[model samples]
Target: MSEPHVHASHPDIARRPRRAEGQLRKVIEMTEAGRNCLDIAQQLQAVESAVAGAKRTPVQDHLDHCLEHAVGAMSRDQRQSIDAFKAITKYL
Candidate 1:
């Protein structure tokens, strides 16, 4: 049997990490400039949230496209669905 085709629409998922990189640079600069700790913390939180969102996007896409499509077949086998779910849960 051939492998199922994966969806390719989550292109912006990769871009989110690049945004986090810039946010990190800003956090570093804020630290060096003796900015308020609260300001720095907020930016750090933004970066963390962005990174999490980046991680989640592909998983969401996988569930929406891949798992949704695979379920019809794996509903019989079950193992593949469970394994795929366990793998994706790390992002949670």
Candidate 2:
């Protein structure tokens, strides 16, 4: 037997566009504060739970979009720089 593919095609998806604006502001603030993936993931938990109860808001969606852009803009050297920064900052 094959496993079922669960997708989020619920009615709330349509309402997401409406909540996107405010959520986007919060995402920007978090990102600007230099929160890393783990921090973002933790915050995502709260956002996801809220989304489950209501609709898919723009905070996570905006974070996803911004992260995609930031990562795409990095070159190999830039990524290495980030790794080095992480290594040094790890001790602090």
Candidate 3:
């Protein structure tokens, strides 16, 4: 039997730049419009699904850079607030 191909094992993955500025800009715009994290995640899913076979560099970039930085800078209360928001959004 032959094995199925998997893009995750591809060699070019590291070279991909996750979270291009354009994608980040879209995310910011959505947030500014009062869209919740779930909404943002849905949009990200659409983008990922639509661009199948391509590396999701932009999304990863946002997580690595913007989200990481924001979380790192937050106080305990702010972190709790974000965590609570995420819990509600994810379960809803």
TM-scores for all candidates?
A: 0.70, 0.30, 0.28
* Candidate number achieving the greatest lDDT relative to the actual structure: 1
Candidate 1 lDDT at 54 equals 91
**Candidate models: Cα lDDT each:** 0.81, 0.54, 0.56
Q: For candidate 1, what's the RMSD?
A: 5.2
Candidate achieving higher lDDT, 1 or 2:
1
lDDT of 2 by residue, 27-73 (tens): 67788998787776666665555455453333334334544566676
Candidate 1, 4-49: lDDT as tens digits: 6455745688789999999999999999999999999999999999
Give the range of the ten consecutive residues with the poorest summed lDDT in model 1.
Answer: 68-77
- What are the per-model C-alpha RMSD values against the true structure? 5.2, 16.1, 15.9
Which is better, 2 or 3, measured by TM-score? Answer: 2
Ranking by lDDT: 1, 3, 2
Roughly what TM-score does model 2 have, to 2 decimal places?
Answer: 0.30
Q: After superposition, how far is residue 71 of candidate 3 from its true place, in Å?
A: 52
* Candidate 2 C-alpha error for residue 36, in Å: 1.9
Total clashes in model 1, counting residue pairs 3 or more apart in sequence or in different chains: 0
Once fitted onto the true fold, the runs of candidate 3 whose alpha carbons sit more than 4 angstroms away are 1-26, 53-92
